[model samples]
Target chain A: MKLSKEEIAHLAKLARLDLPEEKLEKITKDFGSILEYVGRIQKVDIQGIEPFTMPAKSEGWRPDEAFEVDEATRELILANFPERAGDLLAAPGVFETPKK
Target chain B: MKPLNEITIAEARKLLDEGVATSKELTQACLTQIQSLDGALHAFLEVYADDALAAADQSDQRRTDGNVLSKLDGIPVAIKDNMLLQGKACTAGSKILQGHIAAYNSTAVRKLMEAGAVILGRTNMDEFAMGSSTEHSAYGPTKHPRDPERVPGGSSGGSAVAVAANMCLGALGSDTGGSIRQPASMCGIFGLKPTYGRVSRYGLMAMASSLDQIGPMTKCVEDAAIILDTIQGQDPSDQTTSDTEPFRISKLESRSSNDLKGLKIGLPKQAWQAGGIESRVLENTKAALAELEKAGAEMVEIDLPYADEALAVYYILMPCEVSANLARFDGMRYGLRKQGLPLFETYAQSRAEGFGDEVMRRILLGTFALSSGYIDAYYVCAKKVQALIRQAYERAFNEVDLIVTPTCPATAFRLGEKLNDPLAMYLEDVFTVSVNVAGVPAISMPCQEDGGMPVGLQLIGKWFDEATVLSAAKVLESELAKQ
Candidate 1:
C-alpha cells in the first residue's frame, strides 16, 4: 500500500489534524505498515453477509427516562469549562461566515 | 483501624454488615491510598473524595436502617473516564474535553450507585478508547502497579491498575477490542468483557459502539462476578440490553473442576502464528492449558479459517464507527471550544489541537474508510469479514465449549516502547480483538509471570455464556494460586 504525500494530506484534512511537513514521511510510513497489516481482511470470503451496525434488537422500542442530569450538575458542567463565552464555547471556525 | 487497602469488597461488605467498619472509613482508606500512590501510577483522572465519602456515609445510614442495598453496598469502586458518572469529569482521556463533566449517569454507573457502591474516582483511558496502551491518554499513561516502568494495557489501563494497586476494591471498564482484558492481563487482575448487549451502554461515551461493552476489572473473579451481577440486566435506556435472567454467581463455588470434566477447550492454531508473541508468553499459555488438562478439560486444536483477518476487520470497522461517533464532538453541544475564531475554523482547529497523534491517525483512517468512493472498498468489505469472523467463532464453539489463547502477545512493554509505532501497538491486541468481533464473552486472568511481569490467559465462550467463562477462570485462578 503505497501512500502518496497528497493522500496523507487528504487524510489529515479529513481528520482535522495539523501535521507539519517534516512529520509527513514518518506518518506515511507508519500508516503504510498499518494499512499493510490491515490488508489481510480482504482475503476472507464474506459474500452475501449482512453487516451488523448495532446491537441486535426487535423493532420500535423506546427508552425510559431513568437518569437525567439535574440543573445544578448542568450548571457545574457549564462552569467547569475554561473557554466559555456566554453559554457558547469559542473555537476556530471551520465553516464560511454568512453574507453580511 | 483496620487497613482498608487490603480488604476485598466481600470482606468489607461482611464487616459493614457486622457493624465493624463504616463506609466512611472504607472510602477514606481508598482516598488515602490514592493520595499516597496515585501520583506515580497516574491511574485516576479525577478523584471524588468528598462526594465518595458522602455517598459512603449515606450507605452506612441505609445499612443502619436495616435497608441494605446489596452485598457490595458501601464498597467504593472507580469508574473508567469513558463511562459517564453524573457530575464527574468524563474526559475519555483526551484533551479535547479535558474539563468536560458528564451530564448524566451511564446505566452501569447508576446501577453501581443503586447497589450502594461509592464512586471513588474516574480512571484514565486511551483518548476516545483508541490506543492499545494508556500512553495515548492526554493526561499521561498509567504505569503498571507491579512495575512502574511498564505500561498498564489500555484503553482501560487506569481501571486495571487501580484495582491491582488496591486503590479501589473494583472498577468498571469498557472493552472495545481488548481495552479491559489487555490491561487486566498486563496488570495481573481479573477483567471480563461480557457478551455484547449483556450490559447496557446508555451513557458510555462511544468508541466503536458495536464492539464496546461495559464490564468489571477486579482483584479476583468473584469480585468481577459480583460487579457484573449488579450491573447486568435490561435497561430501557439502552435498548440493546437483554432481558436475560439475572446470573447467580455464588453458584460458581459448587461447580467443581469436575464440572469441566467434559468441557472442550479450543486452541486456535492461528493465534500462535501472530507475530511478536514472546516465547515466555507461549510457554505460559501452554502451561496454563496443561493445568486445564490436568483438571479434566480436554484440549482440541481448532482452525478459525478466517481468524487471521480479525485485526484488519477491526481497524476498518472501528475507525469508521469512530469517525461517525466522534462527529458529535465538533466543539459544540459539549466539550472544549476554542474562542475568537469563526465557526468552521474553530471546529477544525479545536479537533486538531484536541486529539492526540494516535487518535488523529484513527480519525484519518476512519474518515477515509467511510468516504463515498472507499466505503465499499473498505467499510462494507470489513463488515463482511467481521461477519465471517463471527461465524468462525460460532463454528468453533460447536465443537469446543470455550477457546483459549494468550491474552496478549507479550508481558507489559516499557512505557514508550510502542507509543511511537502505531502498527506495533495495534498488533498487541491481535489475540483479544476477535472476541469483540464475535460479540462473545471473554475473560483475561493472570496465568503466570514472564520475568517479573504478569502474563494473562484468555478464555472465550459463546455469546451470553459469562457463567461458564468465569467458572473456568475461577478454576484456573485457584490452580495458579496453588502453584
Candidate 2:
C-alpha cells in the first residue's frame, strides 16, 4: 500500500475532518489505489515544463476598495450564523485556560 | 399539441409569440410533469410552482405589452442546486449547507431573470459536485429517466434528468470535470461546457475553482446556443469571467448549411483504442461520425499523446482546489453545526456529521496531496503534466476545427455499479476531463442507443469558440434525428 492507515488519519486531521474509526481502513485502501493511479505523473519527464494552473491571463488587480453593505444584505449575512447573540456571531472559545 | 411540457424551447417560443400559449400555461405544464415524475426520478430538490406561475403571469403581461426581453422570455427552466437563487435554499446537494438560503442571485440566475425566464426550481446534484453519480447527494440518488434502476450521469444528474424528462424546458448545470456533459449524455440531451472564463461563476458553489463553469443543458443545440447567448458575458462580481466575444445566437441561426463541407473534425487516436472504449460505444460513435462524414466534414486522425494523463492531472488538481474551497464550511458560520468543547473540536465534529463519504474522501485526498513533504511529488508534478496536456490540445486544434469522442466508454450503469470503487468512478471522466484541462468548450449530443440507454457523442472546440462547436453539433443533431 502506498499510504498507511496512520497517514490517512493524519491527512484527515490536517484537513480538519473527523473521520470515524470504522471508515478509516476502507478509506486507506481507496486512497492507496487512487494514489497508485495518479503516480503515473511521475513517469513523465517534466523537467523543464512550467506548471499551468489557470487559463485566464491576469487582468491586473481590481482596486482594493471596500463598499458599504446594504442593510438587507448585512442582516442576511448575520442571519446565516449558526449561533448568534443579537448582532454578534458566537463560537466556542479557543485556548482553554489552566486551573487557577 | 403534444403536452406543453414535452415541447422544446424553440417550439414554446413560437407558440407563445403566436398567442397560442401563455407563459402560465407553459409553467403549469412543467409543474404538472414535475408533480407526476419527480417523485420517482428524484430530479428536483425543490420546485417553485407558485413562484414560477407568478413569474409566468408576468411574462404573459409583458407579451401583452409587446415588451419581450429576448427569445428566452417566459420560458421555464431549472437551475442546479449549486447555483444561487436569492431567498431560496441552495444546498448544493450537501447537508453541510442544508438550510442555507442564498442572499443574492447567482450571476447566471440574475441573467436568466433579466431575460424573463421563469425559474422553475433547484435540481439535485452530487454533494458539492464531487461524484460522477447523484447517488452521492445527501438527500437521495436521482434515478435515470428511462430506466429507474440505472443512474443518470452526475453530479448534474438531476438537471440532466429534469431536461430529459421535461420537468423543465432547460436547466443550468455546472461542470468541473464531467459533471454536466456526462449526465447530459446519459440522459439523451444537449450539455454544453463553455470555455473556463466564458461564463461568470459568481454565486455558484466552487468545486475546482479553475475548472468550474456553468452552462446549459437543453433539448436541442440551438436551445443551448440561446441559453448561452443569454448568460455568456463578463460579470463584475466574478473576476475570472473574460471580456471575450459574446456568444451570438444569430451566428448560430445564420448557418443554413446542413452539411459540414469545410469543417475538419479530428478523431483523437488516443480515444479510440480497443480497451479504452467499449465496443458498443465505439460502434455507435463511429456510426454517428460516418453520418457527419457523409454530410461532407473531413475526419482526420490526430495524436494527443498526453491525453492519457488527463484523469490523473484532474484528480490531483481538483482535490487540491476542492480542499481549499470547501474549507469555508466551518460550523461557526451558516448551515449545520454540531456543538463541541473547544473551537477545533466543534469544526471537526460538525464536518464529520455534515459531509458524505465521497466528499470526505476527496477532502482527505486533497489534503494529503497539498500537505508538506508530499506537495512536490503530487501537486506540482500533476500541474506540470497538466501543462503538457494543454499544449498537446493546442497543437491538435491547429490541425482540426473540432474533436470527436464518445462521451463515456459505456452507457449508464446500475446505481451501485461503481459506488464503492472510487477509482472506477473516476475512470468515467476519462474522455471529458481533458477538455476542462485545456480550458476549451465542448458539447455532448446523443448519437445512438446502447442497450436501451442513450450514448453521447462529444464535440470539442477551441478556447472561446463555442460558435463553431454548436453549429457542427446542430448539423449532426438534425441528421441523427432523421434516423
Candidate 3:
C-alpha cells in the first residue's frame, strides 16, 4: 500500500512520535516496504492456526502475590521521577477541581 | 603476567580459586584493553574501572573467607546497556532515554552480582535493540573486533566485540530476534539465547517481551554454560520465567570425546537457498555440516516450508510489541522531557527529540500494524504465521534432535552496506528469527571464516533442551578448533 504523508502522520500521532517534516518522505517510503515485506504473511495458509498469544504456559508460575520492595531501590525509583511531591508523582493535570 | 583479559571465565575461575590471580588484576587487564582499543571499536558505552576494581577486591576477600558464590565469582563481565544495572545509565542506546538510570537491578545483573561477578560496564546496543548493526546506537556504531571497517553484528555488537577483543571475559546480552547470536557469530564467539523462558526478563528493556531473553556471549561455549548456569532460574519478579533448574555446564563439558555417534541434525532445505545468503557463507556452512557428519552425526534434509515467512512474521510482531512497550517513554516521568503549552505537544516534542530515526520508524510501523483497520490484517496475520512456524519446527524436531543453519546469511558487511536498505538489514535475522518465534533455544558458535572474516554456525534445539544443544555445539566447536 502506498502510504501518504497524512497516513504516516496519523500513525506518528497514534504512536506519540513527533516526526520532522523532512524525514516524513523517507518514513513514508520505509513503512511502505516494511509493510510490504511483512505483507507476505497474508499468502501463507494459516487455516486453523491459533495466534501465538503467549510466550509460555502461564500455568507454571506462582499465584499473584505481593512481595516486599527493596527499600534502597525504592528510594532510587522515587529519585528518578522528574517531578515528585512527597511520594506523589507530578504530571499534567487531568481534571480541574469542581466549584463547591 | 599473562594477559588476564584473554583468559576464559572457566580458566579465570581456576586461577582465582588457586590464589594464582586476583579479580582486581583481571579487571585491570580488561580495563587496559578498553583503554587501548575502545577508541577504535566503540565497544563500551562506559568502563567501570574504579567500580570493577572495588568489586574485584570484594571478590578476592570473599575467596579468602572461603566463600566463592559460583564459577563466575571475581570474573569481569560486561553487560548490554539495555539490561538495568542499578545506579548505571541504561539508555538502551536511544537518545530519548539518555538520562534514564536503572533504579533497580535486572535479574541477570542481580544474579551476576550475587555470584560476585564484577561488572566491567554497560556496553552499547542498537537503539531499543531494533537494528541489525550497532550503527543504530545513539553514540555510534561498534566496529568489528577483527576488521575495523566492518560491523560487529549488533544490537549486542558492543558486548560481542568486548568478548572477541578480550575486553571482557563474557557479556550479558538480550536476544529478541538475532541480537545476541548474530553479533556473537560476527565476532567469532559462542552466544546462547536459551529457551525463551529460561532466563528472567524483569528489568530487561523489552523489545519484544515474548521473545526477548538474556543470555551469555563468551570466548568459549563452556563459559556460556557457566554464565547461564549462574543466571538462569525462576524469578518471581518475572512471571513468564520458567520454573526450571539452573542449567549446569559440567554435564555438557563432560563429553570424553568430540563425537556425535547417534546425533540427528536437520538441514532446512529452504535455508540453503535463502535469498541474500552469500556464496562464501553457503560454502562455509556446507563445510561445517561435513565436519559434523565426519564426527558421526547423521545429516537429514528437512523441509520447513513456512521458514521463508519467518522474517516477515518477526518484523511484524516485534514492532507491534515495540510500539506498545515504548509507549511508557512519554515525557511525563523520565529522560528528555520537553515542556510545551499542552500535554500532547509535550509528548510530541520530547519523543521527536529523543528517539532516533530507526526507532521512530519501528514505532510507526508497529503503530500501523496494531492500529484499528490493519490489526487483523497485519498483527493477527503475523501471529498466526508465528504459530505455523512454531508447528513447523515441532514437526521437524520430531524427526531430528537438532537443526543447524548459518547464524547470518552473510558475515559482517561493511558498516553502511545495508543501513539504508531496511529490508536487506531485516534479512540478517532470517536464520535466527524462527527460534524466537517458536520460543525455542538456539546458539551461535564460531565456525570457519570466509575470506578471513568469521562465520558462525547456529544450533537450534527443542524447548528446554539446552543441555543437548550445548553438547552438540561443543562437539562442533571441537571440530572447528581442529582447523
Candidate 4:
C-alpha cells in the first residue's frame, strides 16, 4: 500500500501524536517496511471462517455487575491530575466543540 | 544460616517446614539482596520493604498460632509494575501514571496475598509493556545482571532480572507476546506464559487484552508451578477466564519425570530455516535437542503451516488491541494531564508528551488498522491468521505431545544493536510469538551459552497443558545441571 506523507500526518493527527518533520520521514519509511512485512496476511484464504474478535462463548461469561468506577474513586483519580479546574480537566483548545 | 537470596521457593518451603529457617529471616534476606543489587539492576520499580517484613512476621505468627495460610505463606514475591496492588503505584512503566496508585489488586496479586506470599515490590517494565527492551520505561532501562551494558529482555525484563539476580524468590509477569519468556531467556530464568484465560487478567493494565496473560518468572520450573498453582483460577472480574478444573501444581510436579520416554517432540520446520539466525544458536539448540533425545524423547518434524506469518499477524493484532485498551489513559481520568486551552487539546497534548516513541508508533498503527476503511482489510485479516495459527497448534498436537524451538532467534544482543531498527527488534520474538497467538502454554529454559550469552530452548504445549511443558523443562534443567 502506498501511503503519502500527508496521509501519514493525518493518521498521526487521528492518533493524537505530534511527530516532528524530520521524524516523519523516518516514520514513513518504517511504516512502509512494517506494512510490507505484514502484507502476506492478506493472501490467507479464510473466506468461510467468521471473523474472530473475542473468544468463542465470551459473551456468556460476562460479569453479573458491570464494573463501574464510583464517584469518590473517580474524584480521587481526577484529583491526581496535574491540570484540572473544579470537576473538569483543562487543556489547550485546538478544535472547537461541534454544536448540537 | 543459608542466604535467602540463593534459595528457591521449594527449598525455602522445605526449610520452613523442617524449622531450618524462619520466614522472617528468609524475607529479611531477600530485602537485603534487593538493597544490595536493585540499585544497579533497577529491577524493582518500588520495594515494599516495611510491608514485606511485616507480612513475614505475620506468617511466623500464623505458624505459632497453628493457622498457616499456605505453603507460599510469607514467601517474598515481586510483581511486574503493571499488575495492580491496592495502595501501590501500578505505573505500567509509563510516566503518565507514575504516581497513580491502584484502587484494587489484580486477581493474581490477590490470590498470592491470600496464599501468604509477601509483596516485595513492583518490578520495572516497558512503558505500557510496549517495548522489546525495558529501555522504553520512563524511569530507565533495567540492565541485565549478567552483562550490565545489555538489556534484560523486556516488557517483563525487570521480573526476570529480579529472579535471575536473586532479588526475589519469585516474580509475576504478564505476557502478551513473548514478554515473559524473552526476558526470562535473556536473564537465564524460568518464565511461563499460561494458556490464554488460564490466569485471570482482572487488574493487569491492559496492553493487548486478548493476548495478555499473567504468569510466573522463577528460578526453576517447580517454583514456577508453585506460583502458578496459587494464581491460576477463575475470577468473576475477568470474563475471559475459564471455569475449567483448577490446575494443581502438586499434581503437576509429581507427574513430572526426568525420563522423556514416549514423549514425541515436534520441531517446527520453519524454526530451522536459514538466514539471520546465528550459527551458535542453531548449534546450541541442536545440542539441547540431542540431550532430550538421549533422555528418550522422540523428535518429529511438523509444519506450523502459518508459522512464517506469526510475527506480522502479532504486530497487527497487538497494536490494534493496545490502541483500544489504552484509549482510557486520556488525561481527564487518572494519568498525566497538560493544562491550558481546551479539553481535547489537553488529551492530545498529554498523550503526545507522555507516551514514548514505541508506544506512539503502536497507537498510530493500531488506530490505522482499526480505522473505518481498514478494519476488514487489516484487523480482520490478522484475527483470521490468529485462528489459523491456533489451528496449526491443534494439528501439531494431534501428531506430537510437545513442540520444541529456540526461544529467541539469537542470544542477548548489545543494547543498541536493534534499537534503531524496529523491524529487527520485532523479529527477535519470531519463534515465541506463535505460542502466544495460538493460546498454548510455553516455557523458556536456558539451554547453553552462545558467545558468553545464554541461549534458551522453548517447549511449547497444547492449550492449558502447562504440566507437559514444565515437565520437559525440568528434564532439560537436570540435563543442563549435569553439563
Candidate whose lDDT is highest: 2
Model 3 misplaced regions, further than 4 Å: A55-71, A85-87, A94-100, B449-451
Each prediction's Cα lDDT score? 0.85, 0.91, 0.88, 0.85
Query: Candidate 4: which stretches are off by over 4 Å?
Result: A57-100, B448-451
Candidates sorted by TM-score, best first: 2, 3, 4, 1
Comparing candidate 3 with candidate 4, which one achieves the higher DockQ? Answer: 3
lDDT score, candidate 4, position A69? 82
Please give, for residues B1-483, the per-residue lDDT of candidate 3 as tens digits: 558899899899889988899988999999999999999999999888899999999999999999888888899999999999888889999988887778888998999999899999999999989888999999999999878999998889999999999999999998999999999988898999999889999999988898899999998878889988988988878888887665777779676557898899999989876677888778887888999999889999999877768889899898989999998888787877775336786778888889998888888888988989999999999988888888899999999999999999888899999899888899889999989999999999987754478888899999898998898888877787788
Cα interface RMSD of each candidate: 3.8, 2.9, 4.3, 4.5
- The pairs that clash in candidate 2 are none
lDDT of 4 by residue, B1-483 (tens): 558777899999988877788888888888899899889989998999999989999998888788888879878899999998877788899988878978777899999999999889999999999877888898988999989899988889999898988888999998988999999888888899998889999999999988899999998888999998999987867888987776677666675467889899999888877467787778888999999998889999888787768888999999998888888878766788765536666667788778887888888889889999999889998888888887788888999999998888887778777777888888888888888788889998887644467777889998888888888888888886787
Count clashing residue pairs per candidate.
Answer: 15, 0, 0, 8
Q: Tell me, what's the RMSD of every candidate?
A: 2.8, 1.7, 2.6, 2.9
> For candidate 3 chain B, which ten residues in a row score worst on lDDT?
B337-346
Model 2 chain A lDDT-worst window of ten = A91-100
In candidate 1 the C-alpha lDDT for residue B457 amounts to: 93
Q: Is candidate 1 or candidate 2 better by TM-score?
A: 2
User: What lDDT tens digits, residue by residue, belong to model 2 across residues B1-483?
Assistant: 799999999999999999999999999999999999999999999999989999999999999999999999999999999998888889999999988888888999999999999999999999999988899999999999999999999999999999999989999999999999999989999999999999999999999999999999999998999999999998888888898888887777677658789899999889876276777677788899999998889999999887668899999999999999999998887988876556777778888889899999999888988999899989999999988988898899999999998899888999999999999999999999999988899999998554468889999999998999999999888888787
The count of residue-pair clashes in candidate 4 stands at 8
